[model samples]
Target chain A: MNRTTELHPFSVPRYPSGNPAQRVIVQVLVTQDAGQQRHAQLLARADTELRHLALPQYADEAALGEALATLLSEARVGVHLELHGDEAFIWSLCGVARAAGLLGDEITLQCNESGRRMLFCVHCASLQAGTCADLQPCRQCGVMLEVRRHFSERLGAYLGVCADADQPYAQARP
Target chain B: MSALDARVGETRLITPVIREVSLMPVNGTLPAFSAGSHVQLHLPNGKRNAYSLLSDPGDTSHYRIAVRQQAQSRGGSRYVHEQLQTGDQLKISSPANLFPLHSTARLHVLIAAGIGITPFLAYCTELLRRGAAFELHYAYRAGLSDAYVEVLREQLGEHLHLYESSARRLDLGQLLGHRPLGTHVYACGPQSLLDALREQSLALGWPAARVHWEAFAAPEPGVPFVVELARSGRQVAVGAEQSLLEALESAGVELPNLCRGGVCGQCRTPYLKGDVEHRDLFLAHEERASSLMPCVSRGCGSPILLDI
Candidate 1:
């Protein structure tokens, strides 16, 4: 099926700039490359001072997770969270915020418009990132897969199932 | 609601005006309750009063409640303080929770004034058991109304913050301001204190869902009026000193109710016609057009036609 709004359940979301009801605005970016422009847009619309936290692309992810957890645990009642990054990166941080007790209304996710997306291979239970395609081979099990509209925020990936079960494996994608 | 037969197991003076009463079920084990749950006590003077259960929720053998003798006693408080004794048989309604803890709160901030500390007694115990982070802010007079200060301080250590109102007033604005994210604040106190907390929290842009409160005072007396039940076609005259719910009960018409203070939206009755004076903390503006809380609301001049 085509990537029409009605066909794709995992359509890109429209993020509001800022909420006036929030007393504090926190912008967390996984990478400063494409996220800087979105961060600037959020800052322009925010009435309150925006606290910016940038996670270096090559830094120790575990250490960054610990720091983000600490920061979220100390956040106050009227704080709003803005996340900017690719689906995998942003959803990972979103999970951390959720674990720290931030409700859905308090958080906004802005996924980068780049063609790269995370795809979860259902057959092999493997995760592959980079390039959105209708049909691709699972990196680990080499199964020809069809990208489905179903997306799991917890897994931070679109689901990929074996395409044309009659002909499985990489050979199926003649 | 089924009534539980209980007897006063113990009674002691918590303070000069406050009495801590323990009740044990006359029959089998009592039903378990959570923090912020309260039971309606059928008083000796034929008056029913709701009191917060202050004991640990895990304890099913007995329930504890503290009663502060109101100077303007409408008989319930006076009867409990003056005549109620140990071993006295009593009837209490099953526990109902009106001010439950916010389900996803990362940090719980509890604020209490005077006898309002009762519900938080159980909250603190439950929170501690869960190993959750919390702080209790209590404002009370040192001698007159500080019922649980010593025990709370000993149990909570630095987590308990006390403000003796007689010595200095509690700064509500500062207390509500600068709270960390995921913080849910619960307040139980007199109407004035509850009002101040609501105002301060709103000014700080705190979400209404994050701030919770339970007022301790019963419904204030309103102008006398008459109510006509639509279903039974019976008319009951409500006195100036009696609530509409009390009047209905007196006339043998019982409505399912909890927290007759009007915060719990249990007794929301549809009104066909009347000049309704809505005093409840629950209903929205649009809801007031179609329904009214008979527990605290009243009719002005005209007789109310209730769906009942």
Candidate 2:
């Protein structure tokens, strides 16, 4: 029961604040759903001091992942990330941001979801795409997995396991 | 103190399913434990269950724990409900905290759900004593049970927000509003609630450092399996309800462990073979591939070849 070795960014000394000339913030806006238009507008109108590289509605969400890396590679120490868009896209971008050594405290995100999202299977250790919130056949293993609220950080998706282990043919609720 | 001897001072049904048991030291005062500390009770049924210290951290006179009769009782909760009573002497491990509050936070956001409210009871008291700015948000399905809501309501007062689960869900988005720098959030509750907090916190751009969680649920039981001590070459059969720690200890092998709930990495051991059903939160992604916590974790099937 010793202390966890998970590094906390809060404990790390702040990398200096309030120098707008030195501070370069990266604004990653993945405006996939039309519903996210207002959020995009808000981020654009919110601040004008910091220079931004706005990536809006990339052809594919996966393409935005590569763009995030290039941005972080060239990003300065004072650089912060502001993510505004769909939940899935924002989450993937957040994962990308995390992979690039950006902590949650150093970023700003306004996220929205459209019900169906990508989920990771904890049992099969695979990703299931376009899965709804309700009970459905697991895309990977066909275990009739129920998407549980358990989210695995490593997998970057909600953990879905066998829904009805006891009963063979019980209808699951949403 | 060797699993400090304790007598159940009082066992009251705080709610129909939730039983609040007060444990008094057989002698005088017990060792001091901070808020968020929990004790592992060695029940007569040979099952060890970890319960959060529901009493205030300042008070060392006695320890209190609220045990909810789990729907899927694996003997521990059932034993506490049906067998345990006042004056019953029970063996309990020294208090250990896996969910200790961060020392310095400009603002504390405490979230709890159902029986998970036990840990926060002590946290709320400790925060109030220090006059720290904090808030406790307790989520519950109405009419099910109010384990510590009434008590916490009186203690937390204005700082408590009771979130009810229904069609018009408590806007978790609004619940976790604009983060103002040094706001550290601690959550202890069901996986659903914790998962939402974790996903939402990140979505709202809260750092992994500021967001902390305590998975206080009883260890999910796996199938009966065997353990092979690699060094000694001894094979021990673990029963369906037995933890690998208990099985190891039963076979006269001493394994160091603290916070048997899997938060502490004390019992984490490297495994040579077997598919480990890792139920612990201690091991990181990379470590989980190789190691398993024997306290709350178990092998999926077959034999777990431990490097112990």
Give per-residue CA lDDT, model 2, range A45-140, as digits (tens): 444223333445455667767877776765533346666554455666777876775555566655444444567766677785644455777666
C-alpha DockQ of every model: 0.42, 0.03
For DockQ, the strongest prediction is 1
After superposition, candidate 1 runs with Cα above 4 Å error: A1-22, A25-47, A53-78, A111-174, B44-46, B102-106, B176-182, B202-205
Q: Candidate 1 on A1-174: residue-level lDDT in tens?
A: 234335654453344323435354444444434456656766786455566666664365466667778877876666677776666666667788888877766677766645466888888798877466678888888888897777776776778899878787756245
Q: Relative to the unseen true structure, what is the Cα RMSD of model 2?
A: 21.0
- Docking model 1 quality class: acceptable
Which predicted model would earn the best lDDT? 1
Q: Considering every candidate listed, which one attains the maximal TM-score?
A: 1
Sliding window of 10 residues with minimal summed lDDT for model 2 chain B: B164-173
